[model samples]
Target chain A: MTDDVAVLGAGLHPWGKWGRGFVAYGTAAARAALLDAGVGWREVGSIVGAATVRGGYPGHVAGATFAKALGWQGARAASVYAACASGAQAINTARAQILAGIADVVLVVGADSAPRGFFRPADGDRPDDPDWLRFRVLGATNPTYFGLYARRRMAVHGDTADDFARVKVKNAAVGALNPNARYRKRLTVEEVEASAVVADPLRLLDICATSDGGAAVVLSSMEFARRHGAAAPVRIRSVSTVTPRFPNTVLDLPDIATDSAVAVEPSGETFRSSIARTAYEEAGIGPDDLSLAEVYDLSTALELQWYEDLGLCAEGEAAKLLRAGATTLGGRIPVNVSGGLSSFGEAVPAQAIAQVCELTWQLRGDAGDRQVAGARVGITANQGLFGHGSAVIAVR
Target chain B: MPRVLTPVVSGWFAGDGDDFHLVGTRCSACGSVFFPREDVFCRNPGCEGGDLTETPLSGTGRIWSYTDTRYQPPSPYVTSPELPWRPYALVAVELEAERIVVLGQAVPGVTVADLAVGMEMRVVPGVLHEDAHTTWTTWHWRPTGVAG
Candidate 1:
């Protein structure tokens, strides 16, 4: 494993549907991070931004956009866009800069003022664009894909709707304790059952909503952290950013068809499983090493899928682990102590960073109500559109 | 009323009855086959450029998975706003020869209740929608014993 970089600070602008520009949220988050790090804006040697397409031309140049918003101190700037994986990618960018000796203290930020409702494609029909084609041809909204997966699990693994609801129930309880979560109210399986169906077999409560939010992290080399008076800090051990191997047949989001496997025998592991496996190998840790986990729960069923993919449990045993309370607080490996996307909704760029923020808090023993006691290591897993893998392993 | 004959993607399938076949391109190098046709560069990272020859896909495949879309899909998928929504079954069929899974709407009158894992089905052309002038065509999965 590469030497870890200390997380000097973490900040967030509580997730919600606020009508403000992404820059505003990102700048606010950056300022909060600076204050948390006990450093002035000028002390930041670099700025890495996770870009949002919602911001028009400025978003394409996100590092510069956030840098300008925070008042440019002539800091080195970089911007990255990897769909939902943008935040982790931004973190990866900053980590590289620090490791390369390009920067002593780097600021990484991801914020978005998400649009309302089912995320529609950029207007107008272009059959060539897969995102639009799926909508036009199948009316396959994001939830539709979620629904498909939920049903597939049900058919193949015998997972029931109640099992899906338990995920929301577990996550919402943790969210209730998280001041930064969009939904603080605890949920019940009955409530999930009563909720309207957004997609068949996936209720409204089962899916994450769109929201506006921001998250930022202050990362620095270990020497810089100690010199700056942080005797001990949460260190990021590994950041996995992998691409899918050919012949992926899972029919992922915004795609019309799976890759033809006729040419190549498919890999033994699915893309998601491969993502976590890479991180495990890079960090020299196994699934049993995890103290807690924060996985992208775009839908409740997807969270269980992560349990298997992360190797927290064997295949088709995610629901069993959940029911056995192994994944809840005080269990073998608590998950989503930050409420997950099921509670936070999805601000795309901000969510993954928020996962890291939760990891930082739990590892530091500062997680108030949802604390995973004596937490030493945590992993945040997320997947991006097209084929992008994102997972970060953090240890105290 | 008129039945529209079309493939959502052109040249994916042709002919009728027992002679029906699903067409895909086979890469001369690395022997990788692509459905929906890859006209430009070959996607296999390991292979150099190769001629993509059109080959007929296997006529039958087993169902990998199935689900029904209970809600109406959003735009580009044409449907009359005045009419009530009708849910349709979608199936992922695994073709053994292509070693790939292709998804399509189940033929009319088929529902999720009628499908099971590993059930055999064949690709059939179906009409998506129609206006006074143009009819949108797409592929549908029909059980072999079913009569249209």
Candidate 2:
């Protein structure tokens, strides 16, 4: 017997700069999920929240706060904080609860109200924090990290600015059909090239913006699904939330240095590669089996990097893969069918769950216009600021 | 009078000129090295935890990658609003002996146009910013052949 939990419902609050509280977005998404699942609020035995650092007290006590917003019926609540991977962690927690028989049905919620401009660390003079030190010392914004990765890809793989622009063009075209996407207009490759550089080698269009948004999912045990009068429900096959192996040689975000590989040899797989590998192992599948993928394309070049890390292409061959039209909508294994972060921007806690929500819709044959034709298996990949690794594999 | 110097984060670097080095912690038992200096214990899981000793990282390393900020980064990274934001290059250098990557701002006057991947760059003393009395000193990376 396969260990599977059903994604009974998926819902979202449209992503954009909606000057409002995260609670409103989260509550609306939660209610929509509950309604779509045909499950009553009182029936939900558990709620797992992906927290936003903003929004005062409610943001801090996310799970309980959402429970209260939904007229609390005494649901067991938990909150997760894993930077960008918070949504996946929340979903994983709910899945664990279902698998353990602790709760037959659980609600997972993620929402964020991102501030304008570059995302900054909390106000402080704490030199102990690496996130703070990165800004204070290097003046490195998120785009600079993307720029470094983009430039490196160019040097090693011979990727060009034209290649980077194609990623944005493709994602933007697909995003035009996504109603929940913050940016619905199609982006031309030339337009992307014409945009001012936010970081050298990476233009403003090459990077995703910060946004306000929310996503919610109603997950239940396979047995609970059948009893609730649903058949052929989309199932979550795997959730990988792992830390980096020691001597993580790749320079990741918010860090000034990579682990020293001099002492011990670095693992063959970089941290990102390991994330997808772990999820594939748990799901008993490979990149060949994926009908679609939703990766954290914080930058167009980074999206190409994910292609290699997720095993869709060999290292230094990402640009070639793009040129072949293999990663587009009608390709053998399409990536970011939901338009990705290139469209929705980053809602931090919400984006990962939003990926799953897209997967759920596509699998159900309900993703109109942007549907991945005959999709059966989907995967999402994202990395948290620190060492947190996240990926999820879903299938029908 | 010589400008008073203060390191943005103390113990991260030391010395005035050619004697300079980035300070990291070396695991006495496993020989693992940590930058941004982890003093608690070795990060390597296989080796038994050992006392972390302060160690100097290699002065020169190959540029793993490099980039520059074209816009002013949001604060805590103090930059004056009145002044036109001058961009600075950032480099991730893969140290030779330590086999670790350390990121630092490229030395003043160095731009993204001047650097290439795998070029040798060495640690040097530089000023991050100056306000009234104190000059916030920070480490910088310069191409090996370039003079500070």
Interface RMSD of each: 2.0, 0.7
lDDT of 2 by residue, A168-264 (tens): 9989989998999999999888899999998889999999999999999999999999999989999999999999998898899999999999879
The TM-score of chain B in candidate 2 is 0.96
Q: Candidate 2 — which pairs collide?
A: none
Model 1, position A171, has a per-residue lDDT of 93
* Clash list (residue pairs), candidate 1: none
Docking class of 1: medium
- Give the poorly placed runs of model 1, Cα more than 4 Å off: B1-8, B16-21
TM-score of 1: 0.95
DockQ scores of all models, one per candidate: 0.55, 0.91
Error of 1 at A346 (Å): 0.8
The global C-alpha lDDT for each of the candidates, from Candidate 1 onward, is 0.87, 0.93
Q: Estimate, for each residue in A1-396, the C-alpha lDDT of model 1 and write its tens digit.
A: 798999999999999988999999888888888888898899999999999988898887889999999997999999999999999999999999999999999999999988877787877858688888777766678887787788889878989999999999999999999999999999889999999877667889999999999999999999999999999899999999998999887888777578887767887899999999988988899999899999999999999999999999999999999999998888899989899998899998888999999999899999988999999999999999989899999999
